[model samples]
Structures are given as C-alpha cells and as structure tokens.
Target: MTSININKEKFGQLIHKEKPVLVDFWAPWCGYCRRIGTAYEKISEEYSDILIAGKVNIDEEPQ
Candidate 1:
C-alpha cells in the first residue's frame, strides 16, 4: 500500500485506528528523509495488511 499523506486533520483519527500505525515525520528539503521515503514505501506495501503507513510533511504542516 502507498503511504498516506497525513496532516493535523487526519492525525488524530489515524493514531486511534485499530491497526498498528507507522508515522514518518519528514521534510521535503531533507535529502536523508527523501532517501528513506522510498524504503518506507516499499515496506509499507509488504506489510500493508498489518500496518497503516502514514507520512507527515513538516515543511507544509508544521506543528
């Protein structure tokens, strides 16, 4: 499964979901973040049935 793009609006609901959740906090300008993103997506597909993979872009939705 593809990683879900999450923001403040969806965060609360996602965290409370029954399935296990993997939240990746990232920024567009960070090279390391981008590099790991691809690996994260691949893992998400492999374990999609058991986990909910979500990504939060700090650059756009800072808290």
Candidate 2:
C-alpha cells in the first residue's frame, strides 16, 4: 500500500479508513521540519507496511 496526504478536513476519514498513520506537522520555513520530512519520506517508503506518513503545513491550516 502507498501513503496518502491527510489534512484537517480529512482527518476523520483517514482515521476511520487507514491504520498506523504518521502525521508530519510542519511549516514551510522551518529547516528542521524539512530535514525531518526527508527522513520520514525515506522511512515511509522503506517500511510501507507499518506506516503512512503525511505532511501538514501549520501556517495555512488551523491546528
């Protein structure tokens, strides 16, 4: 299975439909967030069975 993007509006749908979700809360301007995103993406691909990662931009949405 592949990972999908889940946002605030889709939170309920995702929670009900997918198992073992990994949410990445981040801002575009944050360097650390970018680094972590890269790492997460790599891991997401490597272990597709155990994780489903999605990125969230905190600046544009309500948290």
Candidate 3:
C-alpha cells in the first residue's frame, strides 16, 4: 500500500485526476473510526483505480 500526506488543495487535484479517493477524517479517540475502518479497507480493495485512500488524523493536523 502506498501513502502520501496531503491537504485540501491537493485533494482537489486528486478529484480532477479521476482518482477514486476516500478520505477518512478521523481522530484516535473517535469510536466511529474503528467501526468504519473495515468498510474503508473493503472499498480500497474493491476499487482498482483509486489513487488515494487517505486517513487524516484531525488530532495531528493544524486547524
């Protein structure tokens, strides 16, 4: 699996490139993050052309 760090501007480029992108806006303490993890993984595997399936830790990013 490949990973890259990106912000909103890059995310816009991703959309224009026809890359199927999934952004998981999550924090470590969020219970929903755990629940959605499996679903996100399944999506990544299901789509072959997705360029980005990114996990954004809001806890770490500058606001």
Candidate 4:
C-alpha cells in the first residue's frame, strides 16, 4: 500500500520480486516529478495488493 523509498542498495532486489513493480525515479528539484509523485502514491494505495510501488531519489543515489 505504502510506497517504499529505495536507493541503489535496494533496487535490484525490489525489482526482482515476483509481483508487478512500479518504480518512480525522481529528483527533489523537479516540479513534474513531485506532481507525478502524488498520483503515484494514490495509485499505489489503490493497487496495493497487485503490485509493489517504490521510489528512488536520483539526486541521492546517482548510481
């Protein structure tokens, strides 16, 4: 239901899971990223049972 905040360390494992996954790659300074982030969160809650939703802050973990 809740979105997971991930970094380079957790990305591979999370993406490899059996369930469907949605990952939002964004940076703090981007307005468009923030706008979509709200929508992403809502969708995550709505489809929590069917998929895994996560986010990665590109600025923090460029790798």
List model 4 lDDT by residue over 7-47, tens digit each: 87688888788888888989999999988888999999999
lDDT of every model, 2 decimals: 0.92, 0.72, 0.69, 0.88
Task: Provide TM-scores for the models.
Answer: 0.92, 0.77, 0.63, 0.89
Scanning candidate 2 in windows of ten residues, the lowest lDDT window is: 1-10
Q: Per-residue lDDT for 1-63 in model 2, tens only? A: 444566788766666655576788788899998787767888778877766667677887656
Displacement of residue 47 (Cα, Å) in model 2 is: 2.0
Give the per-residue lDDT digits (tens) of candidate 1, residues 1-63: 799999998988988888888989999899999999889999889999999999999988898
* Tens-digit lDDT string for candidate 3 (1-63): 534445766666777766767777888898998798788777766664655777667787745
Lowest summed lDDT window (length 10), candidate 4: 7-16
lDDT against true structure, model 2: 0.72
In model 3, which regions exceed 4 Å deviation? 1-16
State which candidate has the highest TM-score.
1
Better of 1 and 3 by lDDT: 1
Task: Please report how far candidate 2 places residue 8 from its true position, in Å.
Answer: 1.2
Q: Is candidate 3 or candidate 4 better by TM-score?
A: 4
Cα-based RMSD of candidate 1? 0.8
